[model samples]
Target: MEGKRLYVGNLTYSVNEAQLRELFSKYGDVVSAKVIEQKGFGFVEMGTSEEAQAAMDALNQTVFEGRTLRIDEARPMQPRREFDRGGYGGGAGRRY
Candidate 1:
C-alpha cells in the first residue's frame, strides 16, 4: 500500500541483503533486501514512497554484477495455488 517495495530482477545470484541495502542506500533508507535463490530475483522495501521513487529513478539503469538492475514498484502478491488439483493434464482419478 505504501509503494515502498520494489521488484528487482536480473540479479546475480550472489547478491545478498547487505550488499543490496548498501547499493540502494544512496537513494534512501532500504528497509529490506531479499534475493530469492529459487526465483532468481528479489525485492527491496524502502522506508518511504520518496525513497522508492528515488531508487526506481536512479537504479533502474545501473548495472550490477554485469546486469542492469530492473527496479519497479512491487506488484501485489498473487494468491497461492494448490498443486495440480485439476487441469488439462492427467490426475489420479483421470484416464489417458
Candidate 2:
C-alpha cells in the first residue's frame, strides 16, 4: 500500500463511521473513518501504509453488517472539469 487511505466498499447502508473505525482499528491505528450513507461505501485512513495494507488483507471480501466488504487502497480524486454549454443555450436566456 502506497498510502494510508483505504477505500471500503459493499458496505451496508446502516454502517456508521464508529463501526468502521472500530473494525479497522483491529489491524492498527486508524486515523479516521467516514461512511457515506447514501453511497454504501466509505474511506478509512490508517496511521501508516503497513497498517492499511494489513487491514486491507484481513478485511477484503469479509462479511460485515450482512454484506461482503471490498477493501482496496484509495485512489486520489480526479480533478473536475467545468462543462461548456456553448451551443446548448444553457445560460440565463430563453424560457422553455
Candidate 3:
C-alpha cells in the first residue's frame, strides 16, 4: 500500500478501537485505530507503508467478528460542500 492508513470495511458493529489496534498490531506498529460505531467501518494507521500492505494482505477478505473484512489503502477525504436545493420547497408556502 502507498499510504500508511488502511480503510477497514464490513466490520461488525461491536468492534471498537481497542480491538482494531490489537488486531493490526500483529502486522506492525499501529499508529492509531478508529472505529466508527454507527458506520460499521474504521481506519487503521500503521507506522509504515510496508506494515499497511502486510496487514492488508494478511487480513483482507478474512472473517472477523462474524463478518468479512474489506481492507484497502485509505483514500484522502474529499472536501464537503453544501448542497443547493435549487429552490425546492423550503416550507409549506415556498415552492418552485
Evaluation by lDDT, superior candidate among 1 and 2? 2
Q: Candidate 3, residues 1-96: lDDT per residue as tens digits?
A: 579999999998999999999999999999999998889999999999999999999999999999999999999999986554554433445554
lDDT of 2 at 2: 92
Residue pairs in candidate 1 whose N, alpha carbon or C atoms collide under 3 angstroms: none
Model 1 residue 11 lDDT score: 87
Compose the digit string of candidate 1's lDDT tens values, residues 1-96. Answer: 369999999888888878888988999988899889866579999999988998889889789988888887899999976766576543756667
1-96 per-residue lDDT for model 2 (tens digits): 599999999998889999999999999999999998789999999999999999999999999989999999999999976655654445545455
User: After TM-score superposition, what is the CA distance of residue 45 in candidate 1 from its true location, in Å?
Assistant: 0.8
TM-score of each: 0.80, 0.85, 0.87
Clash count for candidate 2 is 0
lDDT of each: 0.85, 0.93, 0.93
Worst 10 residues of 1 by lDDT: 81-90
| Residue 5, candidate 3: alpha-carbon lDDT | 99
RMSD of each: 2.7, 3.7, 3.0
Model 3 error, position 29 (Å): 0.1
